[model samples]
Target chain A: MIQVENLTKKFGNVAAVDGVSFNVENREIVGFLGPNGAGKTTTMRVLTSYLAPTSGRAAVAGFDVVRNSLEARKRIGYLPESVPFYPEMRVREYLSFRAKLKAVPRKQRKQRLDEVMERCRVKDVEHKIIGHLSKGYRQRLGLAEAIIHNPPILILDEPTIGLDPAQIRQTRELIKELGQDKTVILSTHILPEVEMLCNRVIIIHQGKIAIMDTLNNLVKDQKIKLEITGNINDITETLKQLPGIKNISFTQQDLWYVVTIELSNNEDIRDIVYQKIVQNQWGIREFKTERTTLEEMFIRITTRE
Target chain B: MRNIWVLTKKELAIYFYSPLAYVIITAFLLLSGYFFYQFVAGIADATALRYVLEFIGFISLIISPMITMRLLAEEKKSGTLELLMTAPITETQVVVSKYISSLLFFIALIMPTVAYVILLIFWGKPDLGAIICGYLGLICLAGVFLSIGLFVSSFTSNQIVAVIITFVILLIGWVIGWAGEFFREQWWKDIFKYIGFFEHFDAFRKGLIDSRDFLYCFSLIIFFLFLTVRIVESRRWK
Candidate 1:
């Protein structure tokens, strides 16, 4: 579990992470969404005990990240954004070193390294020097390093970046499997990755939590659009009077009226709209209800500023 | 404690694995050995090994900083420092582990110089006291340079800058004594000489075990290492 309270970190005069707080429950995969320089990495640094909060507190597994940093760090598996490594080291060698630093018992270090290597799909490059590996393998090796000690919490910063489509899918599947038993706080630019892997989304902008909720609740009420060709003025009036119609916008193209309707409280106005169109003797051309994807919602929330 | 050991092991591996370290080591061994052989070939000066050690001390003055320039700088450069710090270890452990590893590598480079002492024992009646004091002085002097080197490396990602700054700081300590030459006042001269590392090292070359010299080396080590911890901790705050 991870708890952040009023966490603020400053660089010189600028507050990189300003008054941010969030809680992650056990075994929950929380997507940390933010644009570039949005303080996502700064917050992750604070949570991992790499950076001390300038004016607030962060805890992992009930240990204070600053006061009890060593204990706090023991529970966190952090993969920083750069995914840096000692290029001279072999994949297996680096993982084993991390295993030791993470305090994996000496007896189990080899097994842990092997398991993480396999989980990250980097077993083939175990003995190969890390410098010689491709970007995808190096990124996977960073994952392998993070999970080597099998920490309960995983704080991954852009884990799937620079990977091929197939590699991305494999990493996503691996993270999904990891989230089954561990709390994962994944910060990434990929909207689909977050949509597929994260159950809860925390959209951050300018160092503040802009939107935080389940993936479903982010775009809660789905809207419907109906295009009618006959007696569009009457149809507009009828649609405006509908109980759940929160918004109705019309665009005219020649003889047809394109009605875009936004409903509130999960209202399904389609059947009633269809009935109205039939009852009023209005001809319906295109009637459609679409599910808004996370990309659309992401752009809406992040750009709202 | 074990974390320090683990980190030190990895650092030492890097030292041996990298070609630059080997290059530095070979240069160190060749230069120290050549000067040492010359000191022996010159004649039985009785203080031959001490002169060789003093000369090696000067060499270490130049090379020790290079050995530790990348200790923390490379980690910061590559961003692996985040991996190290976010592990279950304190900043103190990180600094100490790196200092110990660089100190060990310096000692390994000095290991061949021990053969010089063995040669002295075989070829001449060397004063064992001066020999032991010379080694003690070299190790302690190394502690001083390595600590400063480690401190400089902590806050910078540029290895060249780390090396240059470390050399500048150590060279200041080395040359601070020369400025005393211009002073007619014994107090000012004594002050400059006292701060310079050469004065304390000279005492050991004469087979003297002065606690003052030990304190100088120790305080310098503690002082730089302390500054390193503060710099490392300030990264989060900065």
Candidate 2:
């Protein structure tokens, strides 16, 4: 339940987020994919009411971010890029304080603190001072602080940045669990994370939204890569006659020729292709379908003018 | 109001949990105690804290910046300002809570000096009216200096720079009254005398409850606190 229209935030002469527009529906896990300095964090800060947009409007839960900032901020749980914390405070003490600041009911404050600590996996370090916490623990603590109030909207900027691989997977699972009920907008440069976690992806480049679509639609072009030993002309002629084949290209890999066949639709034509290969008595080594990856699409979108 | 209290409690906890508050408070008490003993020994039978309170005011003028330097600056440097400002709290709440916590710690710093007042009462017939006024004057002076320090701290992320610049500003506010003596024009003299922070404390120090001095002290506090709030609010625009 967030709406942003023509949002542009300028820091002096340079615009960090220029003419960016996007909306996120309730319970939709949307990933913001962009390289560094691509206005992902700036967009998030504006939504969280941390930075006032220079021009245009953003509303959260039906409240304007600037005019009704308190109400708007009340619905948002933001985890900033760096995950800042007061180092002297013990982890449990800090979460309680954050819960109070977020206006969690006093009766539920303790329970909420424990719940977030467990969900974020910072319970083991709850008694230790934050300054002494490892980076992964501190990052999780930041996540705990964010959801302490159990806000309906979450704006996480690189929530998995500093975590180890196992921690990253855990955080992804946590975000996925949170996303089942909350509207989540997470930004990251990691393409695979978005592919695994997000239903919708928004790619921003140079302070502008390059593309926004469902993950499936963005990577819809599928191709079959086949490694076979046969007469190159005969293999190409046989693949061209297939019903769903859109295009074919070949590359030589030593003695074997690698054939890339683009498909016209989302269909399994491997059985027919196998039959034709068997009838021709050609030796096939590799035959697998490959969807156009978000990584390749992300590079293409961000690197283009 | 609830948000203000929550933030104020957090701010107070930060002060006590760290060694900075203890070190500064102990140093202030030692310096004030040494000065009080010297003043009493020199006078043979000192009955009034007139000079002692004045010296203590000067010491607070120098010590106050240390208390407030990290209030806003450290938040900015450590990027915690993002967390603080994004919370569902107003700028007034944040600024008021920071001002109140530092004011409370400052009060704690001066509370032990009440023992000096008690000792005076025990040994000799001290002018209770002048001593009360002197202590009130110290509190009001602190309100002025601490507010200014909070205002200065809002401008920089560097704590050392915050302290130095705040010290310079408070020193100027303290000594600006001397400029009045150099001016031949009556208007120039009156302007300096009215604006000088120390000049307002003189009436309270002499046991006279002048409403003009009270108004001046309050107006300065309100002005600086208002400025600090505006500075915090301006952050979002940038």
Candidate 3:
């Protein structure tokens, strides 16, 4: 439901988003993966008709963001970063104002407000002024505002940043449910959030596309760490001599040794390592394959210029 | 049109909810009332309404910036400008709604002055034509000045700076006609006269409805509103 081609937004001499291209299909929950200042918010702003692209094109729901911005915006429910809100207005009043601004029909306005308030779990504080609400409540109110219009597309920039773990999980579930038949593009600093909700991920770094791939493909390379308790020098030398093991390093604690081996390919060397330990009569303390974390992938991909 | 109304209602709600609006309204009413009473006690004529209106016109140059400084500046500072711009509305639409609401709030501040008109009608024979024309002149002058104020407010997120700069701009525009008297060329004097506000507003305050003054204020309103739209749009790039 959203298409961006070579989008570059420049501020003075610095390009906030440079030659970024990506497409999000209908009913897909795509994660805009990036570190802070990776131009994720800038790109989302262009898509939501909040900023004009300096070059290239972006369209939402088949409407060009610049030429037909009103129509493009009509289809988008945007929750911006930091969630700016009127502190004086009540929760329900703010949501109702948004519903009207988004052109929800007068007849259905109350119903729409009610649905979003409940979906976002902001019903209890519906009568409270926004300044009195906590950060989590304010964040939920921002979510409620975005969904109040029931638009076909939702562009949320870091929706769960300041929430408690339970609130974050609840919001994640809500977003997962919302993406069932609508286009949802959410940006976040949390990596596991993507693993849980996003089918596809677009990782950006320093105003450029770092990698765009499925989460399954992104986390395919996993590493294993082996710990040996007898003759630390002998175990370290033996593991380094094994095949298909590239980065073999030894760390010693008292008489125990932790041998970390990075598998160069998909070979399962646990059997070979175990056999070698038995042949040498070294005590095997622990053996486990470590999960390939997004941090590792992010560093390798973003730093590999 | 409905969108404009919706946005305008939001602006008005913001004004009423804040104590700043109350302070401005009360101060305006009290000062204008005191000025009106002084005009009646000193001049003792129907033209007292016109004098009070002229005083309002001058005072609005000071009061209007306070009314309009936070209109767009606060939105920018708080990042609500993104919300408004990303809504299903044009930048021009945002400008228009803000203009209308500021105008409405200006009317609300000036509405109580109608009691002065009522009192005039009750105690003495007031010239109905001049009262209407004088009030018309005040509204027109407000349209011209408030548009400039709105434009200045859009320039920065600092409300105090917006107020100070707008006050300076209006003050300069009001007094620029004085420099025209020193000019040897008729064209230079005419140009300055055209730029100065008091010349256009003087006839209106004296019960004369000159089309030139009306057109000038109307043109100014349109020009500054257009400039505001351009400045707001340019922010996306810079």
lDDT of each: 0.89, 0.92, 0.89
Rank ordering of all candidates by TM-score, starting from the highest: 2, 1, 3
First chain TM-score for all predictions: 0.92, 0.95, 0.84
Worst 10 residues of 3 chain A by lDDT: A219-228
Q: Write the per-residue lDDT of candidate 3 for residues A239-299, one digit (tens) a residue.
A: 7888887787878887777878887776677788888988998877788998687778877
Rank ordering of all candidates by lDDT, starting from the highest: 2, 3, 1
Regions of model 3 farther than 4 Å from truth: A224-287, A303-305, B184-188
TM-score of each: 0.94, 0.97, 0.91
Say which prediction, candidate 1 or candidate 2, comes out ahead on DockQ: 2
Alpha carbon lDDT at B185, candidate 3? 94
Please give the lDDT score at residue B110 for candidate 2.
94
Model 1 docking category: high
lDDT of 1 by residue, B20-124 (tens): 888998899999889988988885677888888889899999998899999999998888888888888888999999999999999998998889888888888
CAPRI quality of model 3: medium
Per-residue lDDT tens digits for candidate 1, residues A1-305, read 88999988889889888899889999999999988999999999999988888998988999998888888888998889999999999888888888888889989877777788888989998999999999999999988888888889999999999999999999999999999999999999999898899999998888888888999787567778777787766777888898887788889998888888888867666788888888888877898887777788778877884
Say which prediction, candidate 2 or candidate 3, comes out ahead on TM-score: 2
**In terms of TM-score, how similar is model 3 to the real structure?**
0.91
| Clashes within 3 Å, all models in order | 0, 0, 0
Better of 1 and 2 by TM-score: 2
Scored by lDDT, the top model is 2
